[model samples]
Target chain A: MSDAEDVMIVLDESECWVLLRSHSLGRLAASAAGVIDIFPLNYYADGSTILMRTTPGTKLVEMTIHSDVAFEIDDFTDEEAVSVVVKGTAEWLDTRSAIEEADRAPLVSWLPTLKYVYVRITPTSVTGRRFVRGPEPERD
Target chain B: MSDAEDVMIVLDESECWVLLRSHSLGRLAASAAGVIDIFPLNYYADGSTILMRTTPGTKLVEMTIHSDVAFEIDDFTDEEAVSVVVKGTAEWLDTRSAIEEADRAPLVSWLPTLKYVYVRITPTSVTGRRFVRGPEPERD
Candidate 1:
């Protein structure tokens, strides 16, 4: 429930992580050169890190050049909406051990593609907000 | 229906615009300094631009510094998934006439907040992809 004044509530760190674990679909945004590119990704949140699979494509190449990226996920209903944003560093899981560990998670590309490259995002900060869905307050 | 080989198909320009208009919830990503930030927002797509309202905050401030931004929206069902990404420049609507015209849209803040500032994104390029949800292809 929301207070009368503030319809948006800031979620704690634990709450943010809980929301992250509950959803598998999200968007990853990374910048290269001067242009920013975002892609829809299906990820697995393991502990405090995010794991995803990508084929050798623009997403992997851009993140290699610029590790700093933003990942976001949101869920909405008729009564309330919640969103979580993660600012993190994305690194490819190159080691054999890392790849084996990532394989344990149920992470798979939504499309039937050959995605052997595993990428992990170590979050620098996680922020979330929950909004109570309702009509806007009247202007004075 | 998807072909037996390729599970993902690239959408054309007109197809992208139609998907953009079908949804109002999306994520906006903007970079300032060196870090990129993504925010979940509800927006109205008009003609060839996207219009959204926000209060004086980080989203507005960062866009003012670097107008270049990326916006993404996605939808998924049990059988298929679709995502659209727009790379564009964002500018705040300052003139009264511009604000008045935006007020006609069915755009409203999800929460009860004063969002008088309207920002519009004029896309330099739009890209979209549709994926048929299925299991990963077997390794050879």
Candidate 2:
């Protein structure tokens, strides 16, 4: 069990996610040096949601097996940036509708080699923050 | 719950981790947005063992809140890069002996602004991958 204080941190509005940061292409990155072969991916906005596509041997197929996964998307430069995380359940959508949506993403042109493998991240919990980097001068 | 048929990728003798290519410097590069907010961090070394430290406001702290977390770290350039991810049931280190071992990590000098908080990370399930964005193709 976690302490009440820790729970509060988990609930922090700055950076607590349910899925991961692979929802969009703002600054998408992922890795799994430890467990479950984590994939932290990101793509650009197309319409109401984010989209991602990988080749046949890619791990995106496995990510679709579970409905509950973590998704995170963020963009930061210097001091200010947006970090959005979504912890939710995902349902595999191999239907024609999902594939069409994946092909329409802006990032599709950016990386044209990938195939369609769309996984919608439904945010169970969403939180984020903004950092000012340097503190304002304190009154002396 | 994950299915047993999860497309598992085997690591060769030379491939220790599945890393991503990042340019953000140290661990910041592998983050979703190169920001300090919003992290689904997972810390894992091997099975049943935790690969994290006890630090305040760090990735491990957030993971140990009884909530499973995902961790990704990376380094990158135009041609080559590496990233790693970990997901698990984050645990904490409240004892002195555990803290001693964690403090001996080689990368501890990267950050200097951690205190008051101890260590924690949920390294229950693990995953990772590597990418080489160069001309010819690189091995993983």
Candidate 3:
């Protein structure tokens, strides 16, 4: 009934955005000084942009050094798995108006630490895929 | 009874390794052409290295351009969240013996696509943190 194929299915841009809006938690990837790092954080998908909050730490520093980043969210069951990736440019919401705008996005920190820095990632490209979980096909 | 603090707790190296071994799915982040990308893939923890299989695609191409990559795994409940990040160098298992060795790992493809390329990530630094999930602490 679904487009669920024998294996992998490519998801369209709209599907990717839908998945992004449905999930609040994701991994943020950024590179700094030749090393790339991934951190799991809470984020809000505001229209086409991804909003997140962070404190003065490695995550913020790395993104500051390199504006290019990738944010990913995924979910899976026994039968299927889906993943969405957004390659974007990250910038801190430094202006008062921008910070006030981000303050309303419902993005909250998981820990008790102060996360005064509001960062937003504007997507350069969004892509997604769906994979049907199954055993490997026998080799010829 | 546990070291579950009210907020965030830094996990030790041994604890990080334990968590890594307990999970099979993670996000691998790599940078290419000044843009970073993250992919969710199923992987096997072989001793201190991460083993995975993939078809010829963007994930493999980017990682080849920059061997410095980050692999991350995370899990969370309503009460707590834990994440482990491994900053590592990824190398394709091209040799006959190396590919044969990787074949022994309990790694299988989730899709029917031919994933002939086997890759291994050797960790340079492994770090983890545990966050006690709760509402933000009231400020003074």
Candidate 4:
């Protein structure tokens, strides 16, 4: 179903608009795709990127097998909340230096080691949504 | 790399644990997930069982396709923050009485015309991490 309302509320209002603006396209947040090792990454608006360390032989290693990925980061508050979502293509880091520069060295989460190296996400589009609490506009 | 050091320092101790304990499962400090009919539904815990509301339409429809999905709720104090990840199975609810009891139906984030429906999530595992402020963590 192509109902915009069903999946994501992509309206032209400031709330949704703010969300799209919050996406750090070149940065990535870690989330489960396979095991904790196969953590997700993202792109930043400035073309730079960010991500926590990922390990080889991890689920992340398997997930980046030339596929598209979705990355999300969000925050919520009483008056307002914002979320950023990015869709992009991903590939593994080819050189060890590139991986080190990205700060994605061998690391651990819950366990002591991971399997995957680095995942480079080339973003296609990034968007966000926000909900602001209190007050309504005066009707003209 | 199953190393615990590989973990990212997500939310501090308090916020991360709070979301894990909150009875609401969905709404709390950080409301997340895709929206419905212009309404922001915070699907929590995991998509295996979602705890959000929708009047009707594709919001409810699209999620039914796969019982598996991801739900994250995040919070922060100053520059430090953490995100909770729940990965598991999702189930759709189809009951009038049950729908009326949804969290978003009435006074909480309510809309008069909107309908209330429930998505239940049963998480297989819930994990979290965030960054610690400072130059870095000193090794133990």
Candidate 5:
């Protein structure tokens, strides 16, 4: 709307991945019964895949029904803002070996509930954008 | 996890609404062809409804196909965190009066792209959680 809002620049793929690895928290989008749902969860970025754990609930149910989902992470201060979105497919880590590896991941739940079920999202597309404020005019 | 993570408490419905009205930015989730998508957008809270504007894109197309969507807002610092989630139905304000009123809403796009189409989400469920750090014990 204003000149300040025109400073958003598209981020390259490398930039997107960097931002993803930098943030620990993000929102995961999944659909259940034709209704979309989002949950704010902590994630571990392992290579190109995003790893997270959740208990039995709507998130797990929707991921099981439909693996195609979106994951997003964003951060902003008074001066700058960055947002990254990953479109990917989710899979439950049911094997003993996979579960063992996930337990060693840096991702830790902030909630008191046990998040034992590990879900992995291998992204097909990664995109992001960054917004920065323009410099102010110099004073006389 | 540790005892520190156990400090997350579920906020009541009123607290959730209060937090929603306090924040301007949130993520909107919509599903298309069984694939879920999310977008970070700014919004205005009008009573029990969430109002936002967007250009014609995947988000608008998906909301048209299925109105059921989810909106989420959150804020956190090093010591505290708060998150609120709303599950609701999305509808385009096609009527002249609805469009006229929504144009005056406090919500404004931060991107250069034109966001003329106003959409309203009437939340059916609102939930939230707040994480606060417990007081540290005195050193021996």
Candidate 6:
């Protein structure tokens, strides 16, 4: 078990992006009708943008109305955890070429539903933190 | 590997609350200043409400301003996944009795920070879904 004195370290932009690219599962948060909704999704990191697919639902409608959204991914062990958050604007990839390229990416919905509409999030800010568990220091 | 013909079933409110009680880790989403943010948190299910603790930061500040937030908890295996979402309003537990009772709750911040403020979310709605993966049927 990890001690209770571990500290959380802030990750830089490059490191944050690296972590984002390394993970495939994330949660997408958007607001509609003054209510916030979050959905778990599988995504692909394409350059500086994040790509995901969704069918017609609250998430798609909310993103279309309010492009500003947040996506988060995290992995944890018993001792430590790393979390990355991306804040950006979401837009649907309506072009044929864009959809074709996104189809080739590794992103796929875990559910067996048809996720034809592709949404891209162009990140405005990317931040991350790594929580490191270690031995507690003795007081002098 | 499971086939690609799995189905997603919408769970009832009772089932959703059951899943929420089963999991302690979740992501909390809040919005402020036209930006949405998500934080990984350890929470406790208190009746129909959700309880968590945190130090002063963007999460706390945003929740105080907007109050409207989304909380999500999900569990997955190689073949299937279950997700639950809670949409609610957040408020700090300021009363002496409230603080004392909350202190005894199971909610604890994983990080080694002083999370003295206890926040409670009275859920407005609770929804859940279960993705069941299985063999695909033969095509005619």
Best by lDDT: 1
What's the residue-level lDDT of A120 in candidate 6?
A: 89
TM-score per candidate, chains pooled: 0.93, 0.53, 0.90, 0.57, 0.84, 0.87
Candidate 1 — which residues are off by over 4 angstroms?
A: A1-5, A64-66, B1-5, B64-66
lDDT of residue A63 for candidate 5: 56
Q: Evaluate residue A120 in candidate 1 and report its C-alpha lDDT on the 0 to 100 scale.
A: 90
Interface RMSD of 2: 12.0
Tens-digit per-residue lDDT, B33-132, candidate 4: 4221112344432222446544556444454334444555544444444556655555566666655555433224322233445665565656677633
Model 1 Cα lDDT, one tens digit per residue, A50-113: 8888776655555644379999999999899999998888898888999888888988578766
lDDT of each: 0.82, 0.41, 0.80, 0.44, 0.78, 0.78
Off by over 4 Å in 2: A1-37, A57-59, A75-82, A109-115, A133-140, B1-70, B76-81, B87-90, B100-115, B120-128, B134-140
Give the CAPRI class of candidate 1: medium
Per-residue accuracy of model 4 over A41-138 as CA lDDT, tens digit each:
33333243323344566565565446555555555566565555555666777787876666533322222333335566665556565445433222
Order the candidates by TM-score, highest first. Answer: 1, 3, 6, 5, 4, 2
Ranking by lDDT: 1, 3, 6, 5, 4, 2
Q: CA lDDT of A26 in candidate 6?
A: 94
Docking class of 6: acceptable
DockQ for every model comes to 0.61, 0.11, 0.53, 0.18, 0.32, 0.41
TM-score, prediction 5: 0.84
Interface RMSD (Å) of candidate 3? 4.0
lDDT of 1 by residue, B15-78 (tens): 9999999898999988877778888888998859999887756555556433798899999998
Error of 3 at B93 (Å): 0.2
Shift of residue A63 alpha carbon in model 1, Å: 3.0
Candidate 5 — what's its lDDT?
Answer: 0.78
TM-score of chain B of 4: 0.55
Residues A1-140 of candidate 3 have per-residue lDDT tens digits of 22225567899999998999988999998887676788898999976999987775555555654378889999999888999998888888788999888877777667665445777889989999999887666543
